[model samples]
Each structure stands twice: as C-alpha cells, then as structure tokens.
Target: MKFLRPALLGLLSLAYPPLVYLGLGHFEPRWMALPLAGMAVVRAVATRERVWLAAAVGALALAASSMLGNHALPLKLYPVLVNTVLLAVFATSLAYPPSVIERLARLREPELPASGVTYTRRVTQVWCGFFVLNGGIALFTAIGASDETWALYNGLISYVLMGVLFAVEWVVRQQVRARHVHG
Candidate 1:
C-alpha cells in the first residue's frame, strides 16, 4: 500500500505532459494537481508530522492556485515547489547534530561509529547540493522550457539522476562499512 502511492504518482507524472498537451489543454488545472494534493493531505493527516504537513500545505496551495485559473503556473511549478521543500529538509538537517541521513543510518545500525557519523554528515551535504541543483534546474525548465521539455525533465531525467546518485551512494556506503569492519 505504501509503495502503491508512489507508483501511482510516478504513473501520473509520466502521463501528465501528454495529457495536458493532447487531451486537457490549458483550462482544467485542478485535474492536474488536486488528486496529488489530496493524497498529500491524506498522508499528512495519517503521519501527523511537520514535514508531511508542510508538503500538504504546499500541495494545497498548488491546488488553490489551479482553481484561480493560472493554468501554466500551478502545473509548471509543482516539481519546483516539491524540490524546494526537500531542499529545506536536507539543508536544515545540517544545521544541527545528527543530520537526517545519520538518523536513518542509526536506525539501521544503532551503534554508529565515529567515521560513520562523519560519512552520514557528508552524504547529507551531498543530498543538500543535489536538491539545490535539482530545484534550480526544475525552476528554469518550468519557466523557460515548453511543457514537454518540463515533463521530460521532471518525469524522467530527474528520477534517473536521483536513482544514480542513490545507487552510487549505496555501493560506496557498503564498501566503506566493509573496510571499517575489516580494519
């Protein structure tokens, strides 16, 4: 069930550009944003976490903007808005002890070594940079590029980049852990 939401979301994102271009045109913005926003709200209500609440608020704001008839703005900015929120989360975690990645690492292995802490912090910083770059590119695409271009980046390229980053990091992390365990 948890995986279902993101799978559906991925499907919607993949379909959005063509739907807008060939089917919906520029009039019905609510159809593009409301369902995602509604899901965000539901997730927020279920989790009751501040982060989820923030996402819900962002989605609701997008939905509201769509209702006001600024067609291009809502659909175009959704990815940018979501990335900005993610950027905030990753960047802010660096401001205090135990960055978000470190906390997750701790969950997996409670007795995190000193080197592990440093590594997680560095990984957190890398994620912060990724979010910044991702959000900037997304914003630029939304503003200057066509809808097809925007959807291509947001729906496909962005996810590919993120998956590559995650895969590389996982491989590196395992190697580091193995070395630590051996020596």
Candidate 2:
C-alpha cells in the first residue's frame, strides 16, 4: 500500500512525453502544466524526500513558466528537468561518499569490499555522464524539434537508450563479479 502511490507516480512520469504530446493537441500549455504541477506537489507530499522535493520544485518552476509565458517550451522541458535532478542527486552522492551505486550495492552486500566501493563510484560517474548527455539531447529536442520528434525521442528513444545502458551495465557487473570470484 505504501509503495502504490509512488509506483503510480513513476508510471505517470514514464508516460509524460506521450501524455504531453496528446494533451497539447487538445489543451493550452498552461492547462497542461496545471495537472503536472499538481502531481509534482502530490509526489513531494507523499515522499517527503529531498530528491522528490527538488523534483517537485523544478516541476513547479516549469509549470509556472509555462503558465506565465503561455508557451509549450516549458511543458517540453520536463525530461530535461528530470535528467538534471537525477544528475544532481548522483553527482552529490559521488562527492558525499558511498556513491549512489555503492549505496544500492550495499543493500544486498552490506560489507562491500574496497574494490567494490571503487567500482560503484566509477559506475556512478558513468551514470552522471549519461545524465549530462541525455539532458543535453532533451534540451535540444525541446528547443528545436517538432512536437512529434520531441515526443518520439523523449517518450520512446530515451527509454530504449536507458534500457540499453542498464543492460550493458548489468553485463559488465556480472563479468566483474566473475573475475573477482575466480581471480
């Protein structure tokens, strides 16, 4: 029960690009942003986590700008905002110690070795780089691409890319584990 709201929110976020594409066809950008802003607020209230709060704040800012300017650019920048917030969280983890990946790794293996710590830090850095690149592309699409193109990339292509990255990382992690076991 506790996880249901957040799970639903995650699904909504995953559907955002397609929803925005459809909503823009039937409504004003300001009208579109209102629901998103409301959702962000709800998510923040539900999570009470700093990361969610930051995301909600960014969502509000985007919604405000969209409503005030009566433009769709802000509506389209949600992906960029998401990427930026994720980048900040991951990068901050790197600086603060126990990089994001290390923290997750520790969940299963509480006593992670020094080598595992180094590996997870490197993985976190890779993810930070991915966010920078992904966010840049999202920003570019929002600014210059057609609505269909933006929706296609943000809604579909970006997710495919993310899956590919995750799969590749998993493969690498498995190989690393094998090497550690046999070396």
Q: Per-model C-alpha lDDT, please?
A: 0.78, 0.93
**Over the stretch 8-78, how does candidate 1's per-residue lDDT look in tens digits?**
65576556545554434645666766665665666566566687678778877877787677465676777
Model 2 Cα displacement at 99 (Å)?
A: 0.7
Q: TM-scores, in order shown?
A: 0.83, 0.96
- By summed lDDT, which 10 consecutive residues of candidate 2 come out lowest? 39-48
Worst 10-residue lDDT window, candidate 1: 17-26
Write candidate 2's Cα lDDT for 36-96 as tens digits.
8987888888976888798999899999999998899998999999999999999999989
Over 4 Å off in model 2, which ranges?
none
**Candidate 1 vs. true structure, TM-score:** 0.83
- Flag clash pairs in model 1: none
Error of 2 at 53 (Å): 1.1
